[model samples]
Target: MKAISLLGVGICGGALIAAGCRKTNFVDKMAFKSAINNYYSTRQDCVWPSPVKFPVQADTSNYEQTKGYDALTDTGFLVRKAAEKKRFLIGSKQVNDYDLSDKGRSSWTAEQTQPGYGNFCFGHREVTTIDGFSPADVSDATQYSVSYHYDVAGVPGWASTVEMKTAFPGVAMDMSGQQSAVANVVKSDSGWQVNSVTPTD
Candidate 1:
């Protein structure tokens, strides 16, 4: 009778373990999807062109005024500005939602604005479709993998000569492409965050 009782306990223990795994996986999947969606949404916003504003008088001496005018005509400047805003959404070692000190922002801004850094600029990004999430092979609950398919258009900057000749005139270049990728999501103490995005083969 004791042997039979031991066997029953073993079976119950195995079932409990399976149940726990299923529950953890379910939660992780949900958290991973949420993080991906948030990241995508912010990326879309980042490419949106800010309203065009040109200074009444060019002020090269004033950095702020000069930067504003440059954004109107220089695609690189706009790209860097948008990148700065996006950094706020995706917290980095230096910049996070909790502590967005001016110092942190300034660091990223300077990086983006570095000379010859911007080769391409995007006017807007529209996500045509997003595929369902897929599980990734990882050992821990804190890390999750997901796959997605998306179509995006990188509108060339206002400065593109090709864009200037558009039928509408002064319109940006339309550069569209499709992408499929796998992304890793990490669960931090604060919440789920996207660790990195990699293109899938």
Candidate 2:
């Protein structure tokens, strides 16, 4: 009876040790979502000038482009000047030229790597869902491709204006619903790290 009691106690202790040593799932949708959100939280949504020049010119015929500048002008971020310039195979046409206003220059987010090039930043992005990811052993895989959706957060009143929304499709889509995006995450000592996030059509 003494030997049987000792054997029973040993079996119970072994079972408890096995349960305690169960492997943990470190990589999952929640982990990826957190990593993606962390990546965007430090970034800004910036719209770069298409022409990359001061006094950017836009032909009045292009309603979308002209309206975009008009919206910015209304927001006090741009100054529009009228001009008449010759067009190919046509008479001189009235054009609208734009340059950054004092407020625009103050709010511009200049690119550190490229001098004399900057953008008007509106807001930051936040992850809403982690749609899916590549299947691999969490412990063995060095990288994973994660598909997700996100929305722009903290959008300013100017960006949400009807004119701005109509002019910039990106702003409209970002504000209307979640936008699809893909991110590459790599394993590191600190856990999953998002390397890059790119918007998907």
Candidate 3:
């Protein structure tokens, strides 16, 4: 409707995939489970930060919440920081925040995101007719885990990259003059606090 320039008010999310297919199997599951268990063995990383405010729907209302941040709120912060430099993604998306639980870990296979775990391959891979920009637009949209890369800072390591489970579907950017993939970086509380979400140009 309006000029969807590189300066709009929206945040974005995406996933990173290893080139080629290296399907994960039984062993990979074991290793991933072991990794999580060992990492959480100290009873850390799984702690849900005290929420500034919680929802009545949440079975437990103790998670950190943001003004527009949704389930993937951890990754939302990075997007927020990136918005300072770009307007195209000023306030594009939101995600629900939850604890990554340092409790007895289970394998990702138990979750079934192999071969394309961090990639935007498995979850909510929808083909719809009209994609609207409201929660109701994708209220019934499928949810899934997608690996996203946030580099609003324009640096590599500074970028926060991780695979996260999210409820919202991907938002398409009407880039009138560019050949950009539906790209974005979401903030999550997997524990890695993101500094920014600079899109790769």
Candidate 4:
């Protein structure tokens, strides 16, 4: 009778272990981190022509436009020079002409559809910590608002310059170290997957 009781206990223990293993779904921190990192892998930092063509020119009077170019020039990604070019009918005017430097050409990803337009991509994000989550419901939880910290991975020197950070707020934010973000994750058949992530306000 004692041997039979021991066998029964063993069976019960096995069942409990199986049940514990089955509980590792979306609520698990490791699972959430994996999903968030996977989502971020597809997002890259890029600088594209806002509404103009490359090999472009911006009037010196246009500080907003010239500042952006000056920042990129500081990173050696773009070459800029002063010139006097003719306007529509305003005669010649002072402008800053910009073209891609050798470094920029190397990292440039040409747009497939738009022949002369492209962007310079820097890096993607990676999860640093899983801070907290909401809707603690485990049994029937279909979605979660996960607060977490993240950092930019594979950032390049050219994209980390003071000028680059100053000109591009996004770049500065990404490099600012251990930034917090909120990600919405939804339950799927396989597991919990990240729906979207946004910076924490």
Candidate 5:
């Protein structure tokens, strides 16, 4: 079984776990599932409204070696490095996902910033979680759900949150402005890399 150390999600404890039926001993851990949502975006295309402090290459001009990455631009640079090979694009279609409550959100905010993600995202209609892997594997999968987190080496902007906006027009109204999308991730030398946040084709 492969093991992974989560860079984001600065919670208490040595580590967390979320195994499937094969290892059904659900602890007070966390996980993610999917659904169409109207959160974290500005465009009506299920794409995140590339934040004003969007993570990118330009932000790494003078990475204060002292701060060790304690600013918005630092984070943008890190995300850019992780996503070096991709752009926002959905890799899978089958609806599936995850999310945290206001309280949970508070938990992450209070203690951690940028809930680091290896793959899994807390909320979305298309990003699904794969189950039944080993404890290490399962935990690794759940850890991936979070997008960014503090304490994770090389990961910046650990204290940022994505605002919600919608995409996908009139086919169904009422849930306007809300947004959701499939998170595209790539395998990296260090680990998984997420780049493009694309939509269904």
Candidate 6:
């Protein structure tokens, strides 16, 4: 009877250990997904100049005395100017044209910071959707490997104009498409953090 009881206890202990491991893995997987989502959301706000050009009239008279003043042109110009100014103001927080927010900045690797590494220099990216998150391969208690798909629509900054493009041929202009990539998430002192992302052809 004593031996049987000991065996039963061992089996129960083993079962408990297995359950704990599964719970940990689930938590890690969610954490990784959250991290990736946060990263994509952060890039949604990129710095870019206005796309509209304002009209300039050479009339310095009363409000109704200007013959060449077009309201549409003036409105468009104001909107564009405001957008451009906002982009310039946000440039201080960007690196390699990517907006790495205060928390997300830690994930940037040296390769991403090198000159001419990213696609857009001064523009905002809109991640329309994210799907196809594969089952995470838990490497261990603290590391996980995963793959996912996402779509983005990007608008180039005013600097990406034809003249600017001619002068700086290497700069990337407006871009929109879907792409897949693999990422590694590791549990750091702060929390679960994405270590790297590699594009899959």
Q: Which lDDT value does model 4 have at 12?
A: 93
Kindly report which residue pairs in candidate 1 clash with one another: none
lDDT of 1: 0.45
Candidate 6, residue 196: lDDT: 79
Best by lDDT: 4
Identify the runs in model 6 with alpha carbons over 4 angstroms from their true place.
Answer: 1-30, 40-140, 153-177
Task: Return the TM-score for each candidate structure.
Answer: 0.36, 0.75, 0.13, 0.75, 0.17, 0.35
Tell me how many residue pairs clash in candidate 2. Answer: 0
Clashes per prediction? 0, 0, 29, 0, 43, 0
Q: Which one wins by lDDT: 1 or 4?
A: 4
Tell me the tens digit of each residue's lDDT in model 2 across 1-201: 999999999998899897885566566678888888788888887554342546689988888668878988999999999999897888898899899999988977777776776777888888887787876445457889999888888887888888887787777887766689889998899978998878796
What are the lDDT figures for the candidates, one per model? 0.45, 0.81, 0.24, 0.82, 0.27, 0.43
Q: What TM-score does candidate 4 get on C-alpha atoms? A: 0.75
RMSD, model 3, all Cα superposed?
26.9
Model 6 earns a TM-score of 0.35
Q: Give a tens-digit lDDT track for model 1, residues 137-189.
A: 43366666667654444443343444233322223222324556677777788
The better-scoring model by TM-score among 1 and 6 is 1
Shift in Å, residue 173, candidate 3: 33
Per-residue CA lDDT of candidate 6, range 1-201, in tens? 999999999999899988774544444445666777666555542222212111222223333322212221222222112111124555522111112233222322223444422221343333333343444444356765567664444433343445444433323232324556677767789887777777674
Candidate 3 C-alpha lDDT tens digits along 21-117: 3344221223222322332233211112222222212212323333223333344322222121222857433333332222212211121433322
lDDT of 4 by residue, 34-102 (tens): 999989898775754242357989989988778878888887878998899876877888999899999
